[model samples]
Target: MASKQAQRLAARQQLQQRMAVKAEEERRKRTVLWSIGGVAALVALVLVAWGAVTVFGADDDEAGASDPDVAELVDEAEAASDRCADVEPSGEGALGTPTEGLTDGRPAQDVYLECLQMSTPDASATESCMYTSVDGTSPTPLSVQPAAGTQKMTIVTNLGTITAEIDTAGAPCTAGSFTYLAKEGYFDGQQCHRLTTESIWVLQCGDPDARGAIEAGTPEMAGAGSPGYQYEEENLPVEAEANYPAGTIAMANAGAGTTGSQFFIVYEDTSLPADYTVLGQVTSGLDIVEQVAAAGVM
Candidate 1:
């Protein structure tokens, strides 16, 4: 009887030890699984953080490249007004005189604005004109006058399309320069840099370097960009009451005789001193400009 009881007790002890060993093995497995899950969660968080930084960094770089300053543009316009005061029109078709007739079938203008080359003795000998780059790939300025006539130009923009009837009769050189630039794709992907809702109501554009929609932090390339060349102004109004009416397309220059690629569209009857060269009249797409003006500057 004593032997049987001892055997039974020993059997019970072995069973308890085996059950404890099994429970310990299960606890270890659960711990390993929890550790693996934590590691995977950490890896996912790192990947998400890396992606966000990359995307935002790219956006910041782009914004920095195209950011523009409104105050600088206003200052530039004021400075241009001062420079134009010293300029006086001179040539065969000076302001208030009839233009020489061209072979192209266009009416002779009652008044013609001619380009007058001014001496810049104080400037560097290498500097032909302000902002004119001699190293650029664009065509050099022609010494002779361009033919005067009517031309239709189509301007395609991200917002919409604009078509204008260029009056080469009044401003032959201005029209010719535009035609040449258009053919070269100089204005493609360029931005309209300036918009003024106050005193002057217009949208200025044609800066190749300023190639983007107007937005906060967009670089101000207006008044700074050029077509690697400069030319004399044309088609200045002779009368004091002459004003830039709605749908008028005109060139934007730093001063008189400093015409380049920059131009503007008049959305309303805005009066100012006749400083800019009148390029043509907008046949379509004035509403695009009006819409931009209504939105105000970004």
Candidate 2:
């Protein structure tokens, strides 16, 4: 009887902690968003935003892509799971998919909102973060704070080497993951696979499996790749009209908390729903991405 009582008490406490985090996220959403839409184009790039299919959201039936990863994470009281299942959407979500009902695959838009809901600070973590292990191959990130308030990420391409200034202040966990992945030589020879020429101008890269299929002249056969572990989003620009501006680099995921190695570099000022996590600014090598964008997608 005493053990059961203790278990109940513990469950109640966990629920309260989760609710507190969700409430703060709601408050942040209510605030912080303003108009940065008319910021003017730094370059004559594209318009519109990345839709569900092509960008971060995915539809997979593999065991690794099951619902347990999201719903059960919170139910099991995992430290990293902020319990986004309980979050109520502020508006009619991007996909209008029901967060409550599901038969097989989850709606991409719903996954996106879940990402937004849990994209806040833990306030209870040590330096090391327990990124959800997916394939047991992801490298653990170093500290989010490197040096000079920002860390430098150099991307050497066939065209030219592009350098970025990772904003650790904004997305510390993401920064750490990037650092670890880079050290492990994860991005060694991976091709920058997806490039959008229409309204959204970006060079999407980092997918390990995006090569052969795309090169075989069948782009549709390409699959989404991950870093083997997963982590929730952080440093969301939920308030900006042009949330992703020119020279911005951000993560690409299949849904909320499904962030993988894939990322997009914005060569234009774009406004998508504030679902993706902003990594930092592409301080250099914007020209390289721009040149590729100008040439258009193959």
Candidate 3:
């Protein structure tokens, strides 16, 4: 009986020893798992930081390679988006086609407006801007001469007399604003600020200082800046399928509803979405555009 009891006690002691060894092994395993998890977390954080640095780092070479004319267009687009950043888009679309006199496409002007409405800072939105039911037979006129009932003004330069007709029917506010500025002689004596030879574009005579001057954090000269105002998109007409042709006088938008004193004359007929207000056609002098281009002010 004593030997049997001794064997049983020995077996019980061996069992306890095995349980302790297993517990120690489990503890080691738990520690290793936690250590591995911590290392993985550190590695993930390092990768994220490295990715951020790579994505946003400055690329001077890439910027230098970009065409200046294209850059200017991009800048204008950014400015336009920034100007309209605050305005929310309404679902209602504009009244005319995507290209009024030119070709046609999908997505109406309201969709473009929506894009400008939703665009973020440092981004741009685009659409096919058109004015149709217009006479496609004649290439658009170089100088505008308004009909008798329309609002018109003539600016005489070395090239000859250039007539500008305000489109009251399509863009009343823009037309009115332009007429007001012209009557005040806002464009007179101001040199065509930027003349791009390669693009054949002329941005002329609106800056109070004819000399090139840029405002800090702004594109225009100090005096040329529109003093805090924008007009509603209600007056403008738009079409979904067509785009506005060259020689169409349109209001350059800063963004949604942010039309201003600055305007653009399309030197070459290219397709632009109905983003700008087409005020009128140039009835006569295009040589003046060439003359303005020859005189560099930018």
Q: For residue 45, what is the lDDT in candidate 3? A: 100
Tens digits of per-residue lDDT, candidate 2, 87-184, equal 34243322333323322221122111111111122222123344877856644443222222555666655555566777755676777676556544
All candidates' TM-scores?
0.52, 0.54, 0.41
Stretches > 4 Å off in candidate 1: 1-138, 212-218
lDDT of 1: 0.58
Best by TM-score: 2
Q: Which residue pairs come into collision in candidate 1?
A: 66-218, 66-219, 67-217, 67-218, 67-219, 68-218, 68-219, 68-220
Cα displacement (Å) at residue 63, model 1: 48
Cα lDDT of model 3 by residue, 1-298, tens digit:
5698899999999999999999999999999999999999999999998877567432322232233532453344334333323334243423233333322121122111121111111112111122221234522111111111244545444334555554544554454445434433455433333333443343333434423343232324433544234454534446543344445556655566666555555555545556667766666655555444344332
lDDT of each: 0.58, 0.58, 0.44
What lDDT tens digits, residue by residue, belong to model 1 across residues 110-157? 111111111111100011112344467655543322333565666655
Candidate 3, residue 265: CA error in Å? 1.0
| Clash number for each model | 8, 4, 39
Best-to-worst order by TM-score is 2, 1, 3
Candidate 1 vs candidate 3: the TM-score winner is 1
- Considering TM-score, which of the candidate structures 2 and 3 is the better prediction for this target? 2
